[model samples]
Target chain A: MDQFIKINSLKKVFGEGEDEVHAFGPVDISIKSGEFVSVLGPSGCGKSTLMLMMAGLLEPTSGEIYFDDKSVSGPKNDIGIMFQDNTLVPWRTVEGNIKLQLELRNLDISKYKDKIFNILKSVKLEDFAKRYPSELSGGMQQRAAFCQAMIHEPNTILLDEPLGKLDAMTREKIRSDIQNLWMINKPTVIFVTHSIEEAVQLSSRVILISPRPGIVDREINIDLPYPRDLSVKRSNKFFEYVHEIQEVFHEYGVI
Target chain B: MASSKNKLSGFLKWIASGWMLILFFVLFFLFWEYSIPLFDVPRYILPAPTEIVQKGSADIDKLIYYTGVTGLETIIGYAIAIILGLGFGIAISFSSILRRTLYPFFVSIEMTPKIAFAPLFISWFGFGLLPKVIIVVLVCFFPIVLNAILAFNSLSNELTLFHRSTGANPLKTFFKIRLPAAMPQCFVGFKYAAINATVGATIAEFIGSDQGLGFYISIVTGNMRPDLAFAGIFFLTLLGLSLFGFVTLMEKILIPWHISMKRINK
Candidate 1:
C-alpha cells in the first residue's frame, strides 16, 4: 500500500512562558492510501489537536506532515473535514451549506447541482434542502454536515468526533452511513473518537493515545471484513477487539 | 373554510397582543384630563392632554413640516453612520495592530457626551441642516462600530477553521462566514444608533437651527405656549417611533434566520 499521509515527530506547545502547556507528540504516524484509521483516546487527550495538524488547520511547533509526498503548510483543496459540532451556518439552508463546497473551490455550480442533490438524497435530506439548520433535528443537521464534507469528493476526509454528541440510535445509523459512504468513495479517512467500540467498529486500525501530554500509547489492528454493519458489531470477534482496546485504557488508568 | 378560520385566528392574535397597550394609554389619558382640573393645577405647570391635542391640531401643518425636516436629517445621518461604522469595524477586525491602536480612541469618543459637541458643530456648519446631520452621525456611529467589532471578533474558531480547511480564501470566508455571523450583533448596534440618531438631531436643532421640531419646541416654550410645547413633544415621539419601527422591519428582512427573529416568528 502506498503511503498517502506521513507525520514525522510531530509536536505542539500552546501559550508561552509560565502559562505554556504541552499539547501532544514527538510522535510519528503513516497512513496508507484508502485506509480508514482512528485515533482513539480519552477527552482532552489531544486527538483533536493531532487531527487539526494533519488537516493543516494548525501550525506544528516542530516536525512536519506530508500528503501524497507533498509537505502540507496550509489547508489543501483535496481534504474535507467534519468538526465535532456540525458548525452549519444558521443562515444557510441545507442545499446552501452543501453548495458552500463548490463556492469555496470556485467550481461551476450548474455543473455540480445534480451532484450536490444526489449526495443530499443519499443522506435522506433531499426533502429538507430549503430548511435552515435551526429547523432540522440533530441527526438531520449531522447528515447535512456529512453531505457538505463529501460534496467536493476530496481524496481525504478528516472526521473529528462527528457522532460524539448523538444519541445511541442516531450514532449507529450515521456510523453505518459513514461505512457505506467509505466503501463507495474509498477516500483515505482519519477519524477521531473517544469511544472504544466506535473506533474498533469503524477503523481497520486504531491508534490509542494517553491524555495530558498526549502520545501514541498503542496501535491495534482490527482485521475486520469490508462493508461492516451493526451485525458485525454483535460478533464475538468484535467483542475481542473492543476488549483488547479496553485493556490498554486500563493500563493507562483511563477506565 | 380553513383559510377563513386561519385569518380569524390571526386577527384575534393581533388584537390579543395589542389590547392592553391601547387600554393603558386610553385610561391614562382619561385620568390626566380629569385629574388636572380636579387638582386646580395651572395650565403652564402640566397642560391637559385635551389642551395639547387642540393646540396640535391648530398648528398641524407647521408641525408636520418640522417633523419631516427632523426625520430627513436623522435618516441621512444614520445612513452615513452605518456605512462608516461597518467599514471601519471590518478594517479594524482584519488587523490586530489597528484594533489595538484605534479601539481605545473609539471608546474615548463614545464616552464623551455627544451633546457637548453640538456647539462646535454649529460653529463649523452654521445654523442650517448640516450641523444637525453631523451631530446625528457622531451620536449614532459608536454603537455600530462597537457592536460590529464584537460581532466580528466573537465568531467561533471552529467555523473559521471549517472554512479554511475547505480551502476558502480570506475574502470568501469573510463574506460567507464572518459577515453573516456578525449580522445579529450588527443589528443590535443599528437599533441603538437608530434611537440615538433622533436625540442627536434634536440636540443639534436645540443648540442652533431655524427649523425642525426642536426649534419649534424652543419657540413655543419661550412664548409661554406650554400646550404647543407639548404638541411639539408629541410629534418628536412619533418621529422616534417611526425610525425605530423602520429599523425593526429591516432586521426582520435581513436576518429572519437569527434566533431572536425565529422565536418571534414562532
Candidate 2:
C-alpha cells in the first residue's frame, strides 16, 4: 500500500543558538493514501508552521517527508497547498484562474476546461468565470480559491486555516464542502487548524501538537460513522474526546 | 416603467445642476464687460468679453483654419503620447531588473524641464510635427509610467497566490489579474498625460513650427492685435480642456469602478 505521506523526525529552527525559535518539529507523523488527518493545537503551537514545512513552502531544519515513496523536497506537482489568503492572479477570468495548475505544467488546457467549469459551477461561480478576483465578495472569492485548489487533481492537499477568514455560516458551509471534496477525491489531506471542534468534526484522525518546538501530544483515531453531522456533538463519546484533548492542553496551560 | 421614472428624475436633476455653472459664466462675462471699463483699462491690456468675441468672429475663416491645424497637431501628439508611454511603462514593469536600473533615470529625466530644451528640439527636429509630438510624449510619459507602476505593483498578494496555486500561466495571470487591477490607475495617468501633452505640443509649436495656434499667436502678438491674441489664447485653453474631457470620457468607459466619476454618468 502507498503510504501517501510520511513525516519523519522533522525540525525547523528560525535563528541562531540563543535566539533560536523552534517552530513545530522533531516529530514524526504518517498518513495512508486516503486518510483525512487534522492537526489541532492552540495558537503558537506550531501546527501551521509544521504544515508549511510539509507543503514545501518552508524547509525543515532536519527530517524527511516522503510522498508515495518519493522523497519530497520543494513544491511537487502531485501536491496542492491552500491557505487563508487565496492568491488569485488579478488579470485572469474565473475559468482561467482555475486552469492555472494545468497551465503551469504546460499541459493541454482543452482537456481540463470541462472539469474546471464543473468545479466552478459546483462552487456557484460559474457565472463569474470572466470576472476578476477583485470583483468577488470574500465568500465568493474563497469558493473560487477552493475551485482552483481542486482543478489540478493533486493526490495530496494541504490546507492552512483556509476557512478561518469567513463568517461562521460561510465557514461551516465551506467546511463541509471541503470534507466532501476530500472524501470524493480521496486525497491524502493534512488540515491544520487550531480549532479542536473543527478537527473533531472533519478528521478521520485528530493529532494534537504541543507548543512551539512542537511535538505530537497525542493521536486518536475517530471511530465515528460517515456523513457525520454536527448533532454528533451531543454524543457522550464526542464530548469525552473533546474533554480528553482539552485536558491535555489544560495541562500545558494552553487550553 | 419604474426605471424609466427614475431616469426622468435623474435627467431633471442634471438640468438643475446646469444652472449653477451657467450662473458662474454669466457673472464672469459681466465682470469682463463692466469691471475693466470702469477701471479705465487699456484695450491692449484687457479686452471685454464682447470685444474678444468680436475679434474671434472678425476673421472667422482664419480662426477656423488655424484651429483645425492646431487641433490636428494636438490630437496626433496626444495619441502618440498615450500609446507609446503605456507601452514603455508596461515593458519596464514586466522586468524587475530593468525597472530597478531605469526607474531612477526616468524620474530624473521627468524632472528635467522640456521648455528649456525647446530650441534644441527645434534645431534637431526642425520646424515640423515631429518636435511637437516628441514634446507631448516627454510630457505624458512620466505620469503614465508612474501610475502604471503604482497600479501593477499594488495587487493583493493573496489573490496572486491563489492563481499560482491553481497553476495559471504567467501571461494569463497578467491579462486577467494584472491588467484589470491596473485600470483605474491607468486612467488617472491618462487624464494627466492628455492635458499636459497638449501644453507640450503648443510650446513646441510656439518655438519653431510654421503652422498651429502657437505660431498664429506669435505672429498676432507682435502685430499688437491683443484682442486676436487673447481670442487665440482662449481657444488654446478650450482645446486643452476638450482633450482633457475626452480623456475623462475614456476613463469612465474604461474603469467605471473608479470612485471619482461613478456618480456622474454611465
Best by lDDT: 1
Off by over 4 Å in 1: B1-9
Q: Cα deviation of A112 in candidate 1 (Å)?
A: 1.9
For every model in order, the fraction of real contacts preserved is 0.81, 0.26
Per-model DockQ against the true two-chain complex: 0.75, 0.27
- Residue-wise lDDT of candidate 1 within A145-211, one digit each (tens)? 9999888898899999999889998988888888888888799999999988888889988999998
Clashes of 1: 0
lDDT of each: 0.90, 0.79
Give the CAPRI rating of model 2: acceptable
Interface RMSD of each: 1.2, 4.4
Q: Score every model by TM-score.
A: 0.96, 0.80
User: How far does residue A109 in candidate 1 sit from its true spot (Å)?
Assistant: 1.6
A1-255 per-residue lDDT for model 2 (tens digits)? 567788899888888889989776789988988888998888887888887777666678899988767786764555777787875654566677777656765669898878888888777788999887767887888888888877878888888888878888887777777777777778888898877777887889999898876899799888776666777767888888888888888998985
Q: Write the per-residue lDDT of candidate 1 for residues B37-71, one digit (tens) a residue.
A: 99998998789999999988999999999999999
